[model samples]
Target: MNAPLSLTTPAVSVDIAGVNLSYGTNHVLKDVNLAIEPGEFFAFLGPSGCGKTTLLRLIAGFNQADTGHVRIGGRDITDLPPWKRDVGMVFQSYALWPHMTVRRNVAFGLEERGVKRAEVERRVETALGLVGLAHLADRRPSQLSGGQQQRVAVARTVAIEPKVLLLDEPLSNLDAKMRVQVRRELRDLQQRLGLTTIFVTHDQEEANTICDRIAVMNDGIVQQVGTPMELYERPANLFVAGFLGTANILKGRIVGSGAERYFEIDGGTRFPIPEDDRIPDGAALVFRPQHATLTDQAGPQDGALSLPCIIANREFLGASIRYGARIGATEVAIDVPFQSGKYLFEIGSSGWLKLWPRSLHWLSV
Candidate 1:
């Protein structure tokens, strides 16, 4: 039997530089540049029609870039065809042939390449075992559940021992519970095999859960690329701030600048701004839902920005409560920890909103 490919040497790295793509007149990807580390689980995250899938296809050699270059393992493969690239792709549709048994589907790639019959059988068995489908090899795709069919698709991709694995929203079609279960299994399998993998998803939760690092894209441009924590805490711009989580934006003018920046809201309410040199004389203030608090206490404390507001609505979200309040003409959303001891205010209840100055982020006007 042929032994499994060992990744003792450094695994292959994928790189793209100044990549651009267009279908006739409509530009899809615009001057995109990214690097995927060897044996790392990297994710491309964005909404629909945001060029995330197009970028994946470029890496897999299914679509060529209109400009720039694509390199694998430090070798330029811009002109290489799909078959010669040695990349495994798992699509969202499961793409399994209904006529072929699970074993034949898993061995399809090797069979087409004219691999020996004995080696194909051995590799197919090994791949099926890896995905926990060894006993069901004789069953057709129609006989398996959605989750099982997805696993078969994964097994088929891995059977060829490709240099890189590309997954394009492979779990999107499954039910919610099945998606969670299969995602855990897929992540475990990828880590155990030490395969260089690139995952594309429109679901932020999925990317945050499985990816070692993620690149957030929008409108044919990459907005930010970092670890989950980095993207959540220090987003590069307004789009990322609103995209990753809920953000409360406030308009204000810079009253003071330099080390001790401060701003005044519409009600002449003064608040200290976080130390950011980029914020000019006029800018907007942005903060997360958790950063603002609805407290009974009045007056300003050290490092706190106070605002007068009336509770407009309250929503129950399991362990936390989302409170919507109106401050003058602006509405603010605040997420507070659920507790029995805390005072539960009714609608139209007037109170003071306290926010930490350090938690506030400045945005250009």
Candidate 2:
């Protein structure tokens, strides 16, 4: 087995203190503070207009901050121009010239820097090889596939040997399968080169799959930052919980703690609380679909948060069965393995849904 890559020092680190931006009274980014380790594949994930792309532009020197400082390699470059900052950016649009050949496009940055003709050629060839586009060096952007064109754009950026690589939804144009394929390649290339990469995307799966750590942002504020598993397992709040994946939130209030920990839900249902030191009075319970199960068995039972639910609908998802159950006026989603041969419950069928106490996450109300 290949040894893991060691990151001795951070290739790029960003420290934004009280960073804020505004355009004629509209506040975009508000006091955003974040740090990215060297050789780490970091992702800024959020919905559109959440200031993720704006942050990327700030790091790339395309936009200047109004209050905070931007640093790369421990040096402040807030006042530097885009060309002076050694940061390579790949855009969603692929931004390649139609008239230029792949090789010429990759060589553009080096040539503009007054690099020798031979050295520019060598760099262009090397970058193209890195992206698996060396065989198509003579083709134009219009003649290549979406994936290939993206690779050319990547080659163009890496040819300049920038200190940080900034990608703003670079795979948004590709189809689903191609997006997956290219994403894996991008991660591999980033690892092999040991480049400090910052990727911005609204797709949660993309962020989770490629990044060493992800910063979840909403409405110009970073909600949480952690590894994929950490974020999935323990979201900081309701927004982080629902945003990262589908979650079933139960309105509840903590009544006790320790071995006698308990919580009371809105429908006058009381259940034992999960083993956690963070529980407090008046908190909410959250769990994912897989964390809760449904059964046709009887009433309130032991070791479960049992609730009477009527099956509203069912959908087969190949690997699992998804059932939409109506609990009072709200719908609760449940998932079961497809191979278990559990008979599909018909609409209007009533049953008890049991949620293990350990799977519940309690948050202050």
- Tens-digit per-residue lDDT, 119-233, candidate 2: 7887887888888888899999999999999999898998888888899999999999999999999999999888889999999999999999999999889989999999999
RMSD of each: 2.5, 3.5
Error of 1 at 120 (Å): 1.2
| Candidate 2 to truth, TM | 0.92
**Using Cα atoms with residue i matched to residue i, what is each candidate's TM-score against the true structure?**
0.93, 0.92
* Model 2 worst lDDT window (10 residues): 1-10
Strongest candidate by TM-score: 1
- Candidate 2 lDDT for residue 21: 81
Model 2 alpha-carbon drift over 4 Å, by segment: 1-10, 252-282, 299-302
**After superposition, candidate 1 runs with Cα above 4 Å error:** 1-10, 256-270, 274-282
Q: Each candidate: how many clashes?
A: 0, 2
